[model samples]
Target: MNAFTRQLPKLMLALTALQLSAPALAQVKAPADSSNQVVVPQVDRRDVRLPRFPSNDFEAGLFGGAFSTQNFGASAVGGLRVGYHITEDWFVEAALGRTTVSDEAFTRVLPGGIFTPGNEKLQYANLSAAVNLLPGEVFFGRDNAKPSSVFLIGGVGTTKFNGQRQQGFNLGVGMKVFLRDWAAVRIDMRDHIFSVDLLGKRETTHNLELSTGVSFFF
Candidate 1:
C-alpha cells in the first residue's frame, strides 16, 4: 500500500506532464501538406472579395436634387440615368437633367438694367464614365443584406439655358446605397463648367448640382 501511494504521485505527475505537452504534440503534427485542406484566416468582411452579383451588368435609375450656380441662385433639378458595368470596378452612364430656375434666381443674376423675371430653364444631357471608389459595403447598417458603393463620375455634356446651347464637361462624386441587390439609392454632387457667348465675349459659368434618387438593376 505504501508503494502504491508513492506511485500515485509519480503517476499523477506523469499525467500532468502529458497534459502540458499535448499542445506541443499538436504543433509538431500540423498537416505538412496543404492539399485537400481548408484553412480560414481571420479577416474583416469588407476586405473579403464578394463574388460578383449576378445580373448586375446593367442598371437604370432616376434621381432628383437641387441645382445651382456660383453666380445664379438655387433651383430644383431632376434627372435619370442608364448605366452598364464594363467590369467589377468600371461603368459607363448616360444621364439627363432639367433644372427650373426660380423667378428670384433669374432676377438675382440679371443686371440692374430694365428686366422682367420670367420662367427660365437649364437642361443637360451627359455621358459619363465612373469608377468604384469603394465597390461594396456601407459602414452603417447592412439591413436586408444589401451592399453599397461610392464612385467618381466625370464626362462631357451639353447644357442649354435661356435659348442658348453650350458644350461643357462635368465632374461628380456619388454613392449608391443598395436596398436590394436589384435596387439602390443614388446620391451625387457634380460640378459643371462651360463657356457661354454672353454678348460678344465668351464667359465661363460654374454650376454645381446635388441630387439623390433610386435605381434598379437589369
Candidate 2:
C-alpha cells in the first residue's frame, strides 16, 4: 500500500464520527433558557353591550266600522278599546261600542216592526282575550318595515237594545301594524252572537262588525 492509501482508512473513520455528532451539536444550538423561550401574550378583554328595545304593555284606541245586525241590516258603529298585554303573544281588552239599528226591513213587512220607532240605539260592552297567531313585519316601501301581528280573540259581555240587556258572545280576528314604538293601526272583523226575543219568537242572532282603528301604547 502507498502512503495516500494508508491515510484513507483514518479519513473514513473521522468522517463517520463527525456525522454521528452533527445531530447532537444542532440540538445544543437551540435555546433552552427563559430569555429565548416562546411567549404567550396576555390581552385585556372588553365588555360587549346588548341592544335595547321598546317595552309597551298597555294600549287604548278608538274604532269605527259597519255593524251588521242579524235582521236589522248594517249600521255605522263606533267603539273604544283599552287593552293590556299579558305576554308577547297574549292580551286582554275591554271594549265599548254603540250603533243605531233600524228595523226598516221588518217595518216593511210588519207595520209595528221590531222597534216601535223603526230605529233604536244599541250598545255593547265586552271583556276579551286575544292571542297572537302570526307575528311578522309589514313593509311600506324599500326602506320602511313595520312590526305586525294577526290575532284571534273571543269574549263574553252584554248587549243593550230595545231597553233590554242580552248576554252576548263575540269572536274576532284582527291585524295590527306598529306605526311607531308607541303607536299602531289595527283592523278587526268580529261576530257577536246573542239570543233575542222579538216578534213573539226567541232566536239566536249573529251580528258582524268590521273596523279599523289607531292605538297608542304606554
Candidate 3:
C-alpha cells in the first residue's frame, strides 16, 4: 500500500474524535449559588382597588355659582345642601338657595303680562332626588390620571319672592371630583320653575342656577 493510503485511517479517526469533543467544549455552565443565598422565583404584579368616593354615603356641601331668569339675563346665586346616598346610584338631598334680582327683572321680565314690583331678592328651598346618570369615571392624561362622577338631580319645593311664597320645581346636573375619602369638589347647574303673580296676573318663570363648592361626606 502507498504512504497516503496508509495514513488515511489515522486521519479519519482524529477528525471523528474532534467532532465528538466539540459539543462538550462548546456547552456553557451556570455558576453555582452559594449556600447562604436564597433562590427566588419571578413574580408578577396583581390588580388592586382604588379609594372610595367622598360622598359615597352621607354628604353636606355649600356652593356659589350663577343664576339666570328667563327674561332678565344672568345673576349671582349661592346655596347650602345636605344629602344622603341611598345607594351607589341614588341620593336624597335638600338645598336652600338665595338669588338677587334687579329692578329691570320686575318691570321688563315678568311673563304673561304681569307687572312685578322691584323684588329685592328670591329665596328657595327644595328636596331633591338625584341619580348618577353617568357615574362612570373619567380618565385624563396618558396614564389616565384621576376619575370623577356625574349626576342628575330633580325635585320640587317652595320659593319666596316679593313678599310671596309659591310652589317650585327644579332639575339640576352636577359633578363630584373626589380628592379624599371624606371630601370632594361639587359643581352644579340647575333650573327652577315657579309661578308668579304680579298685578293680578299669574305666570310660570324659570330660574337657572349654577354653583360650585366643597362637599364633606361620611
Candidate 4:
C-alpha cells in the first residue's frame, strides 16, 4: 500500500513538470514562426528627365556707299546687299553697285589732239561674310525700342572697270541705327583692293568708299 501511495505522488509531480515544459516549448515555437513571417519592404526605380535647347532664326539687310579711286576721279555710288544670317551674330552678303567719274586728263593726251573730254563710268560687285561685333538687337533695338549696332565685313570678289575685269578684296566697318523693327539706316566706310590691267600696265588700286543705306531684317 505504502509503495503504491509513493508511486502515485511521483507520477503526479512528473505530470505537472510535463505540463509546464509544454507551454514553454509552445511559446518558443510561436516566437520562431513570428520571426519567419516578418515582412521586408521593396524599393521602386524611376527614370530621370532633362530640358531641351533653343533654336535660332534667320535675317537679311540692304546698304550703299560713295567711292573714290587713287588715280581716278571721285564720285557718289549706290549699291544693294543681300545677306543670309548663319547665326545671330554672323552673316554672308553679296553687294553690287555703280559709280561715275570724269577722265578729262586721259582724254587730253589722245593722238588726234582734237581736245576730247573723257567721261568714265565704273561698276563694282562684291561677295563678303560679315560678323556682328555686337548683337543685332543691341543696335536695332528690341520689341520695346530701337537701338544702334556695329559690325565688320570682309570678302573677296571681282570688280569691272569699263570692259576690263579685276579680282579684288573688300573690307568695311559700319554701324546701323535702328529706326524701326524691320528697318534701319546704316553708314559704312569701305575699301576695295584690286589688281588692274590698264593699257597693259598691271597696277594695284585702292578704292575708298563712304556710303549710307537702309536695311530690312526678316
Q: Which one is best on lDDT?
A: 2
In angstroms, give how far residue 21 of model 3 lies from its true place: 57
| Candidate 3 regions with alpha-carbon error over 4 angstroms | 1-56, 105-119
Best-to-worst ranking by TM-score = 2, 1, 3, 4
For residues 67-105, write the lDDT of model 2, one tens digit per residue. 998877899999999999999999999999999999888
Measured against the true structure, the TM-scores of the candidates, in listed sequence, are 0.67, 0.74, 0.66, 0.63
> Residue-wise lDDT of candidate 1 within 1-218, one digit each (tens)?
99999799999999999999999888785666868789788875666667965777899988998888555578889989999999989999999999876555444555642124555678899999999988676655455445788999999999997678989999989998888768899889999888766446678988999999998987
For model 4, how many clashes? 6
The RMSD of every model to the true structure, in order and in angstroms, is: 14.8, 6.2, 10.7, 10.6
lDDT of 4: 0.75
Per-residue alpha-carbon lDDT of model 4 for 30-115, expressed as tens digits? 33566568677797878878776433233345555568876765787887877777876787888888887665546567553322
lDDT of 4 at 9: 87
Best by TM-score: 2
lDDT comparison, 1 vs 4, better candidate: 1
| Residue 104 in candidate 4, Cα distance off native in Å | 2.2
- On TM-score, the stronger of 2 and 4 is 2
True-vs-predicted CA distance for residue 195, candidate 3, Å: 0.3
- For candidate 3, the TM-score is 0.66
